[model samples]
Target: MTFAGSLNPSFYQSLWQDCDSIYMQHQSNCLTLQDNYQVNVNLLLLAIWLDSHHQLLDSSNWQQLQQILLQWEQKLLLPYRKLRRLSKAALEQAEYQQMLDVELMLERKSQAKILRNLKSMALNEVSSTEPESNIGRYLTLFNLDSQDYPNLGQ
Candidate 1:
């Protein structure tokens, strides 16, 4: 089980409160070419959760996780994301909108795969509320708000 094993998707979803608005305000263009917003945010949330639960993967595993994320981005997420980004321009076309919905589903499946990977790699149960020391680095990489989530006990 992952750090979030005891939790539900909504818990992770809530970490980035009003996500669409937060995303609009967020300026980092990290992963601009390969990532869709959904995959990126979900990965960030997993990193945060793992760190918070003192279950962050070691470097090798982290690298493996990254590779999987990259594969998903390259193979599944990016194309759909690109299409969705063009949705506004194709607004009057119903088929275009349907395509977005299908792509969104595919994107969500990709997220599920990421979550499964994290779950499979989880090696320890959370024993404390304090996060792992290296979590700050990842937070910086993703431009995530460290304060957004209350400590696990809270």
Candidate 2:
């Protein structure tokens, strides 16, 4: 088992590349692409869950993960928190804007769901990704958007 919260740059890079590929695959409804998406999610989730429970890494690797996580929390999760703190109407507006962004590159429903979940799971409330911002960075790193999940809302 790896450390509950650490990964080296190489490992993270591989996963990041995998995520990009998955995002591209998701652009269409091809059968091969569909299989790739499932495989990608499974691989990412495994790494995330493992990192959540174990700190499997050397000091240097841990530090690298920390820096990467911090960057993600700042750039992505922080904005998410700010958006979530807004009034309900504002939240809906922000969600709608995201739904319309071309770079979102996901099915309409999938993109909407991710935004909604992010609204509910304020940056501070998501422990699997916060405290040290583990899950938060993973999502950003993997390019997976959340649609305000009530279950994830803290």
Candidate 3:
């Protein structure tokens, strides 16, 4: 499918539906709800990125690109995410509005950093000749396994 096709709401919804099922299965006491939730969202965002750039990727560079993205997520995105969550919680008190505003800026900065890192990634410096395989590879990149979520299409 083209990037435009992938952007369709039904297509995105199916992707999230599958990812959410897998997340719930692995979301146990070992993780907080915030971290657990991020896993799915991050992976979905990664899927969107990969789909948007499918024509420029192939199996050879796909794994490497995922590693780069994962590292960026862990080092840059996750910390700011925690800060954002804290700032959101502080909203209940009303006095922390200014602090939340600062946190929002910091969080957006980290997000931009991650997006910058992503834009630097390339698939062997050439476009993939076979785009069909990109979706299969991208879907399984996070180990969500479409086979495990056969009902998502419904």
Candidate 4:
């Protein structure tokens, strides 16, 4: 499959859906990473998806992806997430839900941006008998280790 097609929002959403239970299982750890380490869950999920699809990116593409995700996280996701969290108790249910819907929309837009940029790049398929772990490389970007985030390694 083409990189863009494979990296669509639905692909990431489906993976997220499938991994929801795992996330919940390690919710505390995930939250700690999010709150303390400023981890972007979507990026982590993207790394997992890329590895599972055997879409090995060269260092340049990987760095570009990280930059794209960082921009999205800094400008959109993090602020909205904080808003949603802080407003949950103060806002009416409907209002909170609306905010959540907006956040989800923003997330999809970020995914689309990533997909569009990746489609433009001349990506190559993995040629080695055993491709390296994209997840490991991604975690290293955050000074994280898969051992600490067991769900990610899985």
Looking at model 1, which ten-residue stretch has the lowest summed lDDT? Answer: 30-39
The backbone clash count of each candidate, in order, is: 0, 26, 0, 0
Decreasing lDDT order of the candidates? 4, 1, 3, 2
lDDT of 4 at 143: 82
Model 3, C-alpha of 74: deviation from truth (Å) = 1.9
**Predictions in order: lDDT:** 0.53, 0.36, 0.46, 0.68
Candidate 3 collision pairs: none
Better of 1 and 4 by TM-score: 4
User: Model 3: per-residue lDDT, tens digit, 1-154?
Assistant: 2333334345334543454454455445114323543333333344434444444345544465556556766775567556666777556656466555665565445445444444444432224454343445555655544444333222
Q: Highest lDDT, which number?
A: 4
Best by TM-score: 4
Candidate 2 whole-model C-alpha lDDT, 0 to 1: 0.36
**Residue-by-residue lDDT tens digits, candidate 4, 104-137:** 8887777667766766654445543554666667
In the order shown, what is each candidate's alpha-carbon RMSD? 6.6, 15.0, 8.8, 4.1
Q: Which ten residues in a row have the lowest lDDT in candidate 3?
A: 29-38
Global CA lDDT of candidate 3, please? Answer: 0.46
Give TM-scores for every candidate, taking all chains together and pairing residue i with residue i: 0.54, 0.26, 0.41, 0.72
Candidate 2 wrong stretches, greater than 4 Å: 1-48, 51-55, 87-154
